[model samples]
Target chain A: MPDAPDAVEQAVRQVLTSINGDLTPTETMLLGELEALAQEIQRAKREISALSIGDISDSHIPVATDELDAVLAHTAEATNEILDCCEKLENTAPELPEGPAAVVNDAVTRIYEACSFQDITGQRIGKVVTALKAIEARLMRVTDRFGSVSSAPAEPQAPDTRTQGQQLANGPQLPGNASSQAEIDSLLASFD
Target chain B: MDKNTNILIVDDYKTMLRIIRNLLKQLDFNNVDEASDGSEALTKLRAGNFGLVISDWNMVPMTGLDLLKEVRADARLKNLPFIMITAESKTENVVAAKQAGVSNYIVKPFNAETLKEKIEKVMVHA
Candidate 1:
């Protein structure tokens, strides 16, 4: 039997396909990951909403409140961690596919829009969470695309013997300087 | 028409400032000063005897429009030629800038030739 979810899924797939051109394979994989994460977040939201919300016994209400709080806290922390990862990915990627970057930029813009909506009515943080999840998904796609492209064999180039300032002037370069190397080491240390 | 005409370039981004300065040097306009924002531009304007002012639109503390208005209001600096370069490409924004007494306007991500043409137009018209 045909279902509404099936139709929605088909539409989403069509949109993704239409917009997927020019993305590196890594970007596609990242985007796929992001989509999965967003689905998980949506399920979490549904589960949280499904809990009892009527004038139940006081003891039950406390338990419900505690459970809701715990869920909310977890979601918030996870979202923040995802955003941080996205930021790091963005910083490391030298160049991103233009189409995917536009999509990610659009997602970031949507996050701001969602935050504004929440601020006006003093609503729950769920709207913000949803927007953040969307942004995370977009960023993951962008990074993944960049990663795939970067990993591919490149056309040969002249050996780079330029100073740090010279390289910076030319544009972004891998960390080779003492200061930049130290920073990368520290960042890796933290990750470990 | 000395090559050493004191020119002030104002923008919020350090990268943009350097790019503009380099472009100006190529154009033989060597006497260039820079400010990171509108207020700093004004401070420099008040301190130095600059012949031309090239400013960006969006900035904190004050905007290029505010600086233009202030410059127009001040009797001493009223005749100092001002050109605005901005990312805003809307006709309304251009009209507003023209109404505010800007000598010229150039949309950002512009090339060296476009910048030179606009500057020349402003100089000729002025």
Candidate 2:
């Protein structure tokens, strides 16, 4: 039933009485403890967040995948050109000397056999591409769930320069990027 | 088997199709056609008179295995000779292709001789 001003005064008196009017006792201690608990909860939240997969922004994975794709495609194209030239030479090589002609034809056949790298590498690259696609999908889901780690909005991707087949072609890689042909041959032989 | 038998080569990768076609040409088999994937391959198969089907095992939209199943299921095309080319040399994949009625299997990175041998084996029997 008290007026507003009287009500405020009574509330202040009750709070002072709780602290024994010294103003730096029970109430102050309780307020400080509440603040500390709040800070502790905040720290716990941070720890839990750190336990997540962690931020992967600015990662080179995309660039690496793209570069691998480009390199493989280029290798296949170049090899195809070489095979074409070999085929042409085999066709055009004169029949004057049957021995030389046969030798040249055999050499061309060997080169044609070597060009099989395209098909083999293409399959290998297809497997890698499938894996990369799955990873990219999972990464997108993760970003959607946890939000982006970077504050900067992602830069818009430039238009891809690769043509249709070029994008899909994953040709043979050098020994540095993939296992050597000997390793592959051994693995295949094991299957037999 | 006639060297002039109409052949259909299917692969999503253009380079692969080209390589296969070139290999076929080298073998003096000039009647060759191409499709980009299993779906397109099926369309071509249904529309054309192809004697043999050469397909890559992995492709988007539909795989060669799926195409083989479809081909076998279609009564009109059930007896078509199908050759599967794959990079996977796993026993399971080979068995699966066999179970699906694949006429022949060629592992990737194969030479023209390998291709010729498989085609001859399949065509002679087909």
Best by DockQ: 2
CAPRI-style grade of the A/B interface in model 2: acceptable
Residue-level lDDT of model 2, residues A101-175, one tens digit each, is 878877877777677677677666766867776776676665554453345665697999743323433333443
- Please report the candidate that would top TM-score against the real structure: 2
lDDT of 1 by residue, B6-108 (tens): 9999976554565577567657898999998788999899989998999987665677877888899888898888988765444445556677788876655
Indicate the TM-score of model 1: 0.42
lDDT of 1 at A26: 70
lDDT of 1 by residue, A1-192 (tens): 433344445555666678865566776676666667666755754554454322232354445556655776565455445445544544444366877766664454333223222111211333344444565555445444433525565448789974321222211122231123223223323433
TM-score of chain A considered alone, across all candidate predictions: 0.25, 0.46
lDDT (CA) per prediction: 0.60, 0.72
Q: Tell me the spans in candidate 1 whose CA falls farther than 4 Å from its real position.
A: A1-192
What's each prediction's clash count?
A: 4, 0
User: What's the TM-score of each model vs. the native?
Assistant: 0.42, 0.65
